[model samples]
Target: MNCPKCKSVQIIKYGHTHYGKPRFRCQDCGRQFVLNATRQPIDEPTRQLIDKLLLERLALAAIARVTGVSERWLQMYVFQKFYQTPKAIDVTPKKQVG
Candidate 1:
């Protein structure tokens, strides 16, 4: 089979991936990849839903339960999308006024 990255016919068997999928290395680009990459990316709709839930002030654990996504993944996704970490403001009580 040809290399998917460079479309080169000069491909060599680069052993198997962690899940035992056949991996190939392209001679042209020196890139190694599996035939069927088993990465399941979160879809746009799910991303939007996550953003909505976040805006609604939902707890991370609650959002994870509702969206079926891990809290760590949600945290990383939010950081990547907004280029910043979400933090809550700290409010302190003051003395009562006369």
Candidate 2:
């Protein structure tokens, strides 16, 4: 397939996303783009589901199991707006909680 950046057909498969979508790199412009560029972004249904889980008393692993989203992903997307960066809290560690 041609690259979106350079419109060149010299693109090659670069990598795969965790979601299993193939990533491609443009040889001409050295730009990377997902092969399914036209695919729509994640929908609000998933976001709302995550928000509900965040409000409940469920743990990350418990939420992840029911929602089919990774524990790390659920935490970031749910708490993203509250924190400047998702790394502000470590999901796993021996640190004491304030």
Predicted model with the maximum TM-score: 1
lDDT of 2: 0.69
lDDT of each: 0.74, 0.69
Q: Write the per-residue lDDT of candidate 2 for residues 1-98, one digit (tens) a residue.
A: 68766689999889888779988899999999886532333346766776787568567788778877766666555555456555656543332244
Lowest-lDDT window of 10 residues in candidate 2?
Answer: 89-98
Estimate, for each residue in 8-64, the C-alpha lDDT of model 1 and write its tens digit.
999999999878888889999998977753244566788799999978878778998
Residue 73 CA displacement from its true place in model 1, Å: 0.5
- Alpha carbon lDDT at 52, candidate 2: 85
Candidate 2: where is the Cα deviation over 4 Å? 1-42, 85-98
